[model samples]
Target: MSFIELVGLHKSYGRHTVLQGIDLQVQRHQVVTLIGASGSGKSTLLRCLNALEPIDAGEIRLDGDVVSGPGVDVNRLRRRVGMVFQSFNLFPHMTVLDNIALGPIRLLGAEPRTARDRARSLLERVNLAHRADYYPDQLSGGQQQRVAIVRTLAMDPDAVLLDEITSALDPELVAEVLNIVRELAADGMTMMLATHEMHFAREVSDLVVFLEQGQLLEQGPPEQVFGDPVEPRTREFLRQIVEAGRL
Candidate 1:
């Protein structure tokens, strides 16, 4: 069975439909990257997966259990499926250690000391342990983003949804944030991220999906999607990205 499944997924905001009959499966331990221009529904899809935006129709399943729809325990579902946004979203007043440990302590009911230990381990993973005592304002954009990622990891989720997590960083800082994602991929973390970093997406993704105007136009392995896109629209999009030196 697929690890993460979206069947006939549909979503909209008022009159603007953001996703239309989207069907995709992410196998366990696989890395999937959603690539598209702005307004292509990439971010919305990630949001829907994490139930940040209620879907208009269809079902979402994780590990063969339907987690969407009414009467579902969204709290439990969220404990298994995590999300990190473009903005770090860390609490300004908290130190980096507190920011990461907060989830485990509050949400998971971990012992205060245990939560701190978990945060420290995660900080070490991202090479940010030295800054664990610093506040969000004391860190660079990249460091804060990494802290946010670790904050999500502190929950020990099964699948992590990343919505343009690197989009807000400076060019030089972008790599630091992406490198943590690279490490997660290497560690076999199941993830689906929306990104414009074509080169990184191609390198990290097990499956690459192309979205155009709220539709899944084409999807396949990185080589096929990037090197030989079959859909005309997909080709045009990639061409423009390449021409813009983004791919």
Candidate 2:
């Protein structure tokens, strides 16, 4: 079985359906990228996987265990699947070390010192150890985003869902945040990301999924999907991306 599976999934906010009959499987250690125009259900898909949004129908499974729908332990599911959003959702009042150490100390039952040490190490990995004493508002967008990623890593999640993590960063700062993700990919971290950075997506993803108006239009390896797409819609999307100098 795949490490992560979504079978016949459906989700809606009232009558406005955001996802429809989506079926996807992600293997362990693979990096999957979801790409398309805005409002293509990419973020919703990731949220469903993390149980941040409950599916209206179908099942989501991780490591052969069902994780979607009611009665599932949302807290437990989240511990295994961490998510980073477009906005750096850091605690403004807390220092970087405290923000990164909170989850491990509170939920994972690690001692305070141990959590702080691990947090510091993660920050060091991302070249943010100097910012450990700084607050979120005191750092640049890139540094804050890096801290957010570090916070997720401190939990040691089985898989991570990144929702347009660089969308909120400035043009020059974008690379700094993306570099962290690239390193994670190299380290074989199982991840699924929603991103508009087409080139980075093509370069790092083992699988690229195209979503359109709540449907899975096409999905394949980067070579096949970006170089030789089967769907006309997929081709047009790439054409637009190219014309816009995004690819």
Candidate 3:
């Protein structure tokens, strides 16, 4: 069985269906990227994977066990499959170190001192250890976003979901955050990312899934999906990205 699997996943917000009968499998330590237009269910899929949003139908499985829908422990699932957001979502008053350690201490029950020590190590890996004492407001957008990513990592999740995490950063700041993801990928972190960064997707992904509207239009190796997409919609989408100089 795949490390992560979704079977017939469906989600709706009122009458608007955000995801439709979606199915995907992610292998252990693989990097998967979801690419699509703004309302194409890319974000919703990631949200559903971590149970941030409820799925109206289908099931999500981790290690062959159902982890989504009712009767599931959402908190337990979340600790295993953590996510980072476009907004960074760092607590305003907490220092960077405290923010990263919060989950380990509060949720995973690691001692506060141990959590902070691990947080400092993660920060050092990302070259942010010196900023550990800085508040969210004190760090640059890039630094804050890196802290958020590290915060997700501190939980030692089985896989990480990233929802357009670089979308909120300034152009120059974008690379800094992306570098962290690249490093994670290099270190064999299993990841699923929804992104507009076509180049980065191609560079890091083991598989690229292109979403159109509420369906997955095409999925394959980056070379095949990006260079010779099987579906017209996928081709068109990449063409627009190319025309916009984004691909």
* TM-score of every candidate: 0.98, 0.99, 0.99
| Clashes (candidate 2) | 0
lDDT of 3 by residue, 1-247 (tens): 8999999999999999889899899999999999999999999899989988899999999999999877999999999999999999999989999999999999999999999999999999999999999999999999999999999999999899999999999999999999999999999999999999999999999999999889988899999999999999998889999999998
| Full-model lDDT for every candidate | 0.93, 0.95, 0.95
Ranking by TM-score: 2, 3, 1
- Residue-level lDDT of model 1, residues 52-83, one tens digit each, is 88998999999999989898888888899999
> lDDT (0-100) at residue 235 of candidate 2?
99
lDDT at position 139, candidate 2: 96
* Pairs with backbone N, CA or C atoms under 3 Å apart (clashes), candidate 1: none
Positional deviation of residue 72's Cα in model 3 after best superposition, in angstroms: 0.5
For candidate 3, list the clashing residue pairs, or say none. Answer: none
Taking the candidates one at a time, how many backbone clashes does each contain? 0, 0, 0
Q: Could you give candidate 2's per-residue lDDT for residues 49-80 as a string of tens digits?
A: 98878899999999999998778999898999
Better of 1 and 2 by lDDT: 2
Segments in model 3 whose C-alpha atoms lie over 4 Å from true places? none
Determine the C-alpha RMSD for candidate 2 after optimal superposition of all C-alphas: 0.6
- Location of the lowest summed lDDT over 10 successive residues in candidate 3: 68-77
